[model samples]
Target chain A: MSESNLMMHHYLAKYLRQERMPHIWCEGCGNGILLNCFLQAINELNVDLNKIVVVSGIGCIGRVSGYINVDSFHTTHGRAIAFATGVKLANPELEVVVISGDGDLFAIGGNHFIHAARRNVDIKVICANNFNYGMTGGQYGPTTPLDAWTTTTPYGNIEHPFNLAHLAAAAGAVYVARWTSLHVRRLKASIIKALQKEGFSFIEMISPCPEIFDRYNKMGTAVDVMKWFRLVSQVRHGCDPAKAEITENEILVGEFVDIEKPSYGRLLREMTSRVQDKLKREES
Target chain B: MVDESRAVLTGTHFMSGDLACAEGALAAGCQFFGGYPITPATEISERMSRRLVEVGGVFVQMEDEIGSIAAVIGASYAGKKAMTATSGPGFSLMQENIGLAVMTETPLVIVNIMRGGPSTGQPTMPGQQDVMQARWGSHGDYEIIALAPSSVQEMFNLTIECFNLAETYRVPVILLADEIIGHMWERVKIPPAEEINVVSRKKPKTPTAEYQPFKPDKDLVPPMACFGEGYRFHATGLTHDEKGAPETVSAEVQTELVKRLADKIRKNAEKIVKAQRVMLEDADVAVIAYGIPSRAALSAVREARKKGIKAGLLRLVTIWPFPQELVSDVAKQVKAIVVPEMNYGQLVREVERAAKTTPVILLSKLGEEPHRPSEIIEAMRRAVK
Candidate 1:
């Protein structure tokens, strides 16, 4: 399909709320691309639509949940993971995923993010790291690189940004990966893997915020950002996520962590059955 | 359905108020408890940790109170009856998410074991300070049902009522138990599971294709659709339309939605509000009180009657919808209304408003102990004068 035709009449249109279309995302914003990738992954897996739930917190990407044609929840700021934790544990039969932005996941909601990953809750989390708070007019956030310019940081940000891949792996997520919007096919592949993973899975998508982040940082435009990602991105599978960092010159992107452990829901179910059995034995 | 043998603890047993509250929740078919431990309220978390496991339910010790309430709302959305227990400090942390629960019309219960506090004032003592906070702590205009349990037995009974009210109205109900009631051990009769009244949230009877998650019925509460039920509906904290879609810029949508949220409880106040009026028929003065302080008010009323003072007691079982008519009725029949509260004064302000022209004297106590019967009797004497 031609690029224009693909953009105009995507096959995944059925997965979106058509009535709510002509989405409010900015013309050059990467949220639409990231959401398209997510829906593509969901479609490829052919997972029961009724069995999947999308949860998001406040941010530009937070609106992703509302646009999706599924049982979705747009929760309070920075609480998507915590809310998804409840949903997954209550009904382990349902597949829960949280799609939110860097600020909403790591700044205001940083504690919940680390704890949910630590518990290895059976939920998938996809963080759209546009380096700044795009929804709120480009404020520098936890993922914004040191010395990066943003609306809030007119003089450039002095605070160190978080290496999200390192943080997720350190917090005990069973699967961790990173891909830019330029790597759409690869990102969708990683998402499919993350969705099927048994424990807390995290994917950090280095998205483009051309209208704000690019404008403030003198990074040209949305097309320029994609070209920059293609030139500087390195594919390294099974590398130490701690060593994988996004610097001004280069961005390391690939699957960083993949291992297995019993998820919180599975552990909880096991413990409950054990306790119930013991009680039954005592009564018998 | 509850596992009667495991969850009901059906025989009469001596237990603390917090333990009884946990049992009441289990009997009410509360399958999920997400909580953070705090003083006075910790026993509820500890007890549920054990009981929920035995009953094959989920009990999670969340990282913080904010997460605890957030998880409770999530679990409730997934078709589980869910609750969280915390004290003053933790309850303060939960206010924002409580507002989210209100906006989404999620059914869940929050058990706030009252402690003295503007911020962490007293953790190990009793105070009715959060009664006002429970009604207004969350930001924005909304109404909630809050119950004050005076005794250990009421702690059990009222927790169940909190769940019922929560499910009935699709709102977060607060069981405002104080430190004294939570810690005290007393005889609590446990009825069989079959005898206990449990109400679940109304589920959408409409087909998945036609269901609008926020479309309200005549009672002004929309039927809920759980996540995996094929409804494929959306829920948001923003001011939303009947389709559960955000309408942030629409004043018409905001007014219609917020008004319905408040009026559901206001319109149904008669069914939700509960109070115990003691010898109020021929009273010259009335003592309006709730929670642990109401015990002293009861004793004071009895002593006042013996001393030939026609004083009566109006013990507030439900605090949020503030039994305005009941207080107004008593105020008209009485010379004055005396309000004894653990904090300097919280609910007294409500009584003052309710008792329009009648003088309402405030007997404010601070720190550990509640007002003594003698102290309340003195207030009653002043009221009569």
Candidate 2:
């Protein structure tokens, strides 16, 4: 198939709410590309659509949940992971996926992110790293590089950015990966793997916010940012996440960690059954 | 399905108000508890942690109060009856998601064991300070059901009632308990599960293809569908349409959504509001109080009656929706109303509004100790004069 034919025949239309489209993302924003990638991943996995819930926090990425044609939740700011945790625990049969932005996940909601990962809750968290708070007009976030310019950091962000892959791995996520929107095929594959993972899984997608982050900096447009990513990105499988931080010149992107652990719901069910058994034995 | 064997703890036991609250939740078919440990409210979570596990339920100690309420709302969406307990500061943290719960119309029970606070003023001490906050803590215009329990037994009874009310109205119900009632221990009788009235949210009877998630019936409450129940509907905190889709720039949608959210509870105030009127039929002065202060008010009313003073007690069981009609009715007949609250006259404003012509005297107490019966009697004497 030709590239145009492939783009025209993409399976994403069926996964989106027809009326809610044309989405609210800016013309050159990378959120649309990320959403397409996510839908593609879901299509490839062939997961039961009714059993899948997409939960999002307050951000530009958070709006994705509202647009998706699935059982979704657009929760309070920075609470997607916490809410997803509840959904997973309440019904282990459902697949809870959280798609939110860096500031929503790791800044105001940093505590919940780490704790959910620590508990190894059965949920997939996809963080769109746009270097700044895109929805709130490009404020400096936890993932904003030390010298990157944001609206909140006019003199350059003095604070250090979080190495999200390292944070998730250290916080006990069973699967962790990072990919840029420029690497759509690779990012979708990683999302598929994260979705199939048993325990808590996290994927950080380094996306471009051309309207805010790129404009504040001297980066040209969304196309320019994608070109920069393609130019600087290096695929490194099983790279130590601590050494896999994205700098101005280098973007290390690949699968960093995959392991097995009992998820929170599994352990909770085990404990509940054991307690019930004991009660039955005592009654007998 | 009331699982009598697993849920009911049918016996009289000496327990604190917090423990009774946990037991009440379990008896009311609450299967999930998401909470963080805070002063006074910690006992409730601790008890829930042990008891919920035994009852084949899930108990999660969340990182913070924000996460606690968020988890409760999530559990409710996934078709589990869930609750969380907190004190003043934690309740303040949960205000954001309380609005989320209101906007999404998720049924949840929140137990706010009130402490002295503007900001963690007295963690170990008691205060009825969050009365107004319970009604208006969250941003924007919305209504809530808050019940103030004055005794350990009432804590047990009201927690169950709060859950039932939450399920019935599809709104977050608050058990506006205080530190004193939470810590106070008393004998509580637990009825069998068969006898206990447990209300669950109505589920959608329509097929997935036809169901509209936010389409309310005549009672103004939409039937809920769980996440994995083949009901592929979206829920958002933003202003949404009947299909549960976010429709942010539409003024008509916003007006209809907000009005429905407030009116559901306001319209049902007659069924939601409950109060105990003691010696009110032939009294010139009425003592209007709730929570721990109401105990003092009851004593004062009895003492004033013995002293040949025409005083009565109007103890508030359902604090929110303000019981305006009942208060107005009492105010018209009575010469004066004395409101004795632990904080500096919070609920007295409501009484003053309700009792327009009659003087509503405020007996404000702002300390660790509750109001003494003498202090309330003195206020009643002043009101009668």
N/CA/C clash count, model 1 = 0
TM-scores for all candidates: the values are 0.98, 0.97
Which stretches in model 1 have alpha-carbon errors above 4 Å?
A1-10, B1-5
What's each prediction's clash count?
0, 0
Clashing pairs in 1: none
Error of 1 at A68 (Å): 0.5
Model 1, residue B124: distance off in Å is: 0.6
What lDDT does candidate 2 reach at residue B223?
Answer: 96
Name the docking class for model 2. Answer: medium
B1-385 per-residue lDDT for model 1 (tens digits)? 2365677878888999999999999988899999998998999999999988888789999999999999999999999999999999999999999999999999999999988787878789888788878999999999999999999999999999999999999999999999999999999998888899989888889989899999999999999999999999999998899998999899999999999999999999999999999999999999998989899899999998999999899999999888999999999999999988888888888888888999989988888878899998887887777
lDDT of 2 at B378: 87
List model 2 lDDT by residue over B218-279, tens digit each. Answer: 98999999898888889999999999888889999999999999999999999999999999
